[model samples]
Target: MRSSSRLKRAALPRSAPATSAGGSKTDGNHGLIAGTAAKRRTKKEADDAQGPSKPAPKKRRKVIPVKEPEPAASGSEASTQTSHADTKQPEQHLPSLPLDVLYEIFSVLDPHGLIQLTHTCKYLCTVLASRKLDWAWKVARKNSPGLETWDPPKDMSEMRWASLVADTSCSNCGAGGVTSVDFRLRMHLCEQCSKDGLIHSSRLAKAYPDLLPIVRELVPYTNKKLHSNKKSDKYFWIDDLQSMDKKIRKLQAEDPSAVDDFCKERRDLVKSILGRASYLRQWHARYMESRVDFRMDQIAGRFQAIGYQFEDLDNPKFYLHPLVRLDTPLTDAEFAEMREVLQPVLAQIKQQRTKAERSSKVLELYDQYKKTLLPIQRIYVPDDGNFLWKYPKFSALLTRDTSLEITDAEWAEATDALPTYLSRFIEAKRDKHIALMHDRYPAPDAMEFITLAASPQALQHAREETMPHFAGPLELAIATFTHREDTVVRYNRLFTGRELCNSWFEKVKFQFADRESGLVAQMVRMAGLNPRSTTATEMDDLGAQFFCRTCHNTDHERAKAAQEPHTLWACSWRGLLDHFRGSHPTAIKIGLVNHEFYTLERTHNVIDIFENWCCNHCSEEAVAFLPRQAADDHLQAAHGVLTPSVGRDVFFRPPALNVMAPHGIQSYYQFKDSIPPQASLSTKEPSPTS
Candidate 1:
């Protein structure tokens, strides 16, 4: 409110004390009264009594008989006093503080106190509601940490207190309940004492899982308000077990058979998806190795070198890689004829020095031959699939094949047709390859691979390059894929367990009478099934030790090398070795996996033939541009040469198995949240809401 308005309100008159007429006290013992007198009786009192009677008779003319009092005027002081006396006291009241004092009080309050005070009193609530008050609190939180934190050192007192106060209200009867809800005051409240205890704890745990870790840390260290004895370790353990038992009972009561059925369904789906995931990875890997380099070249050439200039000063000429007018040479016969015709115009061309004049002269002479044919250079790879398999049955099958064969047409019927068809087909194939790669590409064990891979420049010094040995199988596997690069490997299950222990295995190595399982095998089993330590150091040590005993011992050079080469360093080696060790020889490094795009497109083709025996449109499209059967036939008919097929298998495909399936999702949207909060209703539904 404005200062003027406040001043006017402060000037308001207060109630006056009640009084009788003539300024005397009123009746009910609240006003003045006259005293009664008796006559004197004595010998000398005859004269004295006569004198007293005479004195009384002389004053009997009455006090009010003098000048009459004037009537009070409406605007006079007397009238104002009378009006004020009639007014009653106000019922509402306010603190006896100046505005500045109130502001100071508001400034001292923390966020929690402000929110509470805002709800408690009308005046305080108004002050808190003001935007200015909000700005003040924001500044305070930013500037004054101590004021904000009630007990900062002790369990992050601000948050702990806020959490306690907020959750203290009883959920059933609310705050009005006989038992005030302050569960945090005690470590665990007995449900027997209050039936709502279990329900409250469950709700609290569900609502505040993020805060649970901090609470769990603090709860064990401090004494609860009411549960000093019950807060011991034994009681806490019993409470936890009891809570788990209660939860189990509740779940069983809700739907025992349904839960079992759901678990079974989940297991089966996981198995199916896991199976598909393997095929997808194998196909993706082959595809990537085939086309990764080509794709990288295109990425580097087109995108990386878009805006650059190169000048050859030594040649003393300005050479432009003309976008429109590329250089072409005329044959001797054509040149002779052109020269003969241009001889007459040469003088005129020279005489005309201005650009416009020369241009006009040249245009007039070449009017009839304005159109020029710039020979369209072949940029795409040549397709030789049909020629390679030209047998009648093979041709028929290959003609239908979209994987290796780019097109079915023997020749282009129109000029535009070739470019359009090639563009569309390449695009379609690239897309297919990319999808296949994503599906097939296995997630690499980056940590392990980086740890193992040969350091840069070390490959040159090494006597034996492991990558080269594997490179052939790896590249062949890569080349096997026509589209998706990642579609090259399949694993039944991802092994996550302990690693082989070098010390234990080494100790058991030459004991003649000792009866222990193969140390390597035992170590592998232990690492796979149960690890001794959770630290990264332990896993790495175990992995390195195992590698030394098995893969490293064969080559002295490899053993001597401080850092392993590309193949040994790869993360896949760790994952695969670990995988094999887990389930004996059931799973091993059957194929390589990669994540690049183009490689996957090529690999997709390989996987289509090798694993799924299906066509991927994306890889097919990419291969179309590179040179397909039709293009190869064109080359035979036109250039009579074919490009190699080694580069055709690189394409990346997306994983086929859904990563979110285990979480009860058919598509990405089903799990809007990390975990589904809503229970499935088709199994069972709550009774219809009346």
Candidate 2:
């Protein structure tokens, strides 16, 4: 009865109306549900009547709950809420594009941009590597600015050529900073990788003796000579050598007779590769040079936009700047980022250059001023003038604000004023010396409350004798301070340290006393006088008969060989004192008292005393009791009197012995072989001549 009811219900479906739960006819959704059920039943019956093949079940999608619309907000509130919603919206990624669209997009990219795009995702990498996309890579290479003239080799694909040209990382070890491309090997290698992977031709036979001769000839090689005298070594890429070796071995194993054909084909391929590599090498050099020039121009333009000018834009500081050194086109944003660091460096360089230029100008003006002042100095201050620049006033003039503006006329005026500055400088120097002397050697009466004073004559004589000692040390200190060329430091005494001056004075005073005592001892010994009892006047009476043993001995052999007289260096006691002070102040030696020199001097003294002749025409300062012949020569030469009577123009008087040889001795060789009277005399201080 159920089966019959089901069959009857299934058969009654033509435009059937559905009933409600109350058994009344319903007009809305019930009719629609009944019609959809009847249609599904009919389709099932149709599928059951057909053959057994059935479609796979479809997965049901999740149903999301619908949100109802809210009441409209006020205009400002609505905008605020809309903006908040926009801000909270999830980030959207690049949508998948059709291959046609991607190909067009990639076509416009450069090699570097295409390389970067390939690394973004595996999808792009796989798509870019596909054979269909090869046209896009060719377009990219073609559109590249500098590489438009170049194309991939026969064996190299477009993508590979782009990577080889664009990639900066080593293909072997993945190291960065690579700028060179080995197009023959289709690899970018760093210095270290190249070193490790390259096999020199010199080592190739020894390292791989079994490597075929044809394989060696067929491999592309790089010629590099470490030294000029040596022949360039051929370096083959190790991988290329191995690959060719392996290929040759496989060919021999597969077909023993086909090796020659393989070698010929490889030789042709390698020849083409080498020729292409050579051209690429030259192109790479020019391209790198152009790139560097372009980068420098970019840097210069950026600097100029900010009001800076560089005469040498290729200066290492600018050329090596991180942003400027990049192997890419510099963008405005990149320049702006680097400006903060680079601008300060530019400013410093500009300041340094400006300072150097100003210093050069100042030095030029100084040199001109120096030249002008030198002649004036030679005329006015010849005796004691120092370099003009070594004066404080002159240095100040050079460094003054208006120094650069100083004209030739202004310099002339300055030169005229230099004499006055020199006077003040001398005065100041004297005052400083006096002050240092006072500090070093205080006056005896300085501490004595009621000390008796010396006579004016005595005081003046004492000062005259002492002043020269201070002058030497003061000059030494001045020279030491002015050793550098800086004008500011050349003359400033404050910069010349006070302690240095004091130390110099102390040193000079001590050395002077020691040297003077040694000289006095030497003089007394040579004069055969009692050192304890010999007065200054007594020593002076010895006249200028002494010679500096140090100087004479140093030049004795040379002089004797040349037959030249050694008497030229002979001087009186006073002259010897001056010579010692000037030439050998630190050492004191008098010529040994040899009998030959002693007898010669004594004989000359006797002749002068016996003649008793003097020059009466000359003033007291010029008067001298000369020997008869010497007197005649003097009258003729000095007074222009060829003949003068002893009672008239000349007078007779006994004079002290004048041991000075006013004219050099002509008989020096005559006494050269004479024996010393005191052969045992040594450098030891002689016993007081008792």
Candidate 3:
């Protein structure tokens, strides 16, 4: 059975797809186990007992054919009615499977396995294909348990809802590994089915005006596009298509006078549950992200206990393990058991890795003979390339291999070739990484691009992500993570990191350059602030799209009240960047980058950058703007040096307006209550600007 199961899994991806319980083919969707989508389930999760790691189907371009009416030859109405009665059953085999017993057995089977069972014969297929049999799958889903939450649409039938949990295939088409379910549409389909089968409710309404009233009464306008300028999309709920069709048909049976009342009641019910499913879906998504973050921190702590130090806890290695992602959270004893299971595999990998390193070094010397000495010295050997490591003439450097021992004459020749190889190898490697251009250096703004690039989420970035909507710090984290460029020089200093990729090397070249259009667009559309302070160009020239928009009109601000906040956006990315640098001070630092790297709020001339500068010795702005030497002297004389600064410009922009911290820099979680209280430092002394 174990071998059979292995064969089934191995053959699943390449072979013809298995059919669904309703006798539909689920194909072209079987590949790649769910990675992050796998979560820490508990022991109670029966659906995950066999550990399929139930992957979402691989996205591809298979078409979704329109569903046709049920065939008369598919099943007999007489058998369906009389099978539940005392005389006879519709099933030819499995005579003892009372409906309840059948459900009990099927409850343990996932959708994929249950579908396969139904395909055994036409009798088994007909027996399982009726509406009454839907309860069996429903019971199966309810009995199943896991970290994943499946909330079916309000109008969907029980069997359809159960299919999402019991099987990993499309009921309509038999697409395998179909984890991406849409409750609003009432189906778990592969990507193409989603695009092809489901039409927007608005589009449907326009096409069929006669049925428009019924569709509008049941469906709602929702799921806004990520773009702020686009209209809200409409969707018709079709999870329980039979039930929806039944309801629509019942109106035809009603008295003409009573039909209006029935329609009104239906509309009211839909409105009551209108966004309920959407709300739950959104909540689940947010919960999953936070849970992944929490689990990663726990893993980092566990590694720290075993002697690994991780300065950046958010690093991908901590959170992305295959077993960690797929398995349920184990109790202490279970974790110990799992650890024992993995120890041998880990040891073998480590041993092979060590030998491979030694083997590579040995091969490098032979490679150098071909690359360097062969052209000049005409070095020759009897064996083929890679002979040195494959058929060693001397003992393996890292292992005991008696056969590798050679004669004294061979040793002498080997020694002659090795001396010059080391220097040349080191030089070659250094040359690859050291040479960098001016455009390759990174500045602060590149963090967002870096984070998205480094993350697993980067795979869908172009299709799904909209960078203009991200907050400053989140964007910076992404950029810092993914960008890898070798930068030799910057404004005045130099960039040391070779983290930014080459493609971005070109983009960052003109990123903060004077009056770049891309930067202007980001400032106006993304950061929600104007760059008027830095750029001389107006919003119109950069294209009015580079400003805050309401209904696609970026011509001017949407009219409101004077007391209300501004809706208009600015045109200069650098202008807003400079404005943040000047007015908000540590906002971009606290918001975009960590505070450990920032020294102080850079002053313009001889003035306090932000108004909140308070001193331990003097509770005024006078000490805040003074040169470092003067601040130390005031603290030493007035405050008795009890509170001393290194005279290394570490002063902060203390909060005003009876606040906890500065407004934009509120994310500085490390510094709460650490700021000094207001006091007098110097007696209004004069100081020179540095």
Question: What's model 3's overall lDDT?
Answer: 0.37
lDDT of 3 by residue, 237-331 (tens): 33332244456667667655776777787677566555465665565455445544554555556645775434333333324555444222234
Q: Which stretches of candidate 2 lie over 4 Å from their true place?
A: 1-167, 172-175, 181-186, 191-217, 221-258, 268-290, 311-316, 351-365, 376-690
Cα lDDT tens digits, model 1, 153-173, are 222233222222222222222
Against the unseen true structure, what C-alpha lDDT does each candidate score? 0.29, 0.52, 0.37
Estimate candidate 2's RMSD in Å: 24.3
Output the TM-score of candidate 2.
0.41
| Cα-based lDDT at residue 514, candidate 2 | 32
Candidate 1, position 113, lDDT: 49
What TM-score goes with each of the models? 0.13, 0.41, 0.31
All predictions: root-mean-square deviation over Cα? 38.6, 24.3, 28.3
Name the candidate that leads on lDDT: 2
CA lDDT of 34 in candidate 3?
23
Q: Cα RMSD (Å) between model 1 and the true structure?
A: 38.6
Worst 10 residues of 3 by lDDT: 679-688
lDDT, candidate 3, at 680: 9
Across 1-690, the per-residue lDDT of candidate 2 in tens digits comes to: 001111111111111221224635443333434565797798778878775787634744333343553555667777678667656332211223333456678878877778777666545665565444567788887776677777766666677777777666667665667888776665666666666777778787887887777788877876652222433567777767777788888989999899888788878978897778878877886776676667778778878877776653546777777767777666678777888888777766765555455456545544443333311121112232334555554455455553145456755665556645645544454345445421243322111000014454543343233222323333221211212223542122221112223233221321122334445556666677654434443343345366666776676567678977544345455445445655775666665334344334222332333554566444333445556777778878886878764333454343221122222121122233453213323423242232
Clashes of each: 99, 2, 35
As for TM-score, the candidate ahead, 1 or 2, is 2
| Candidates, ranked, TM-score | 2, 3, 1
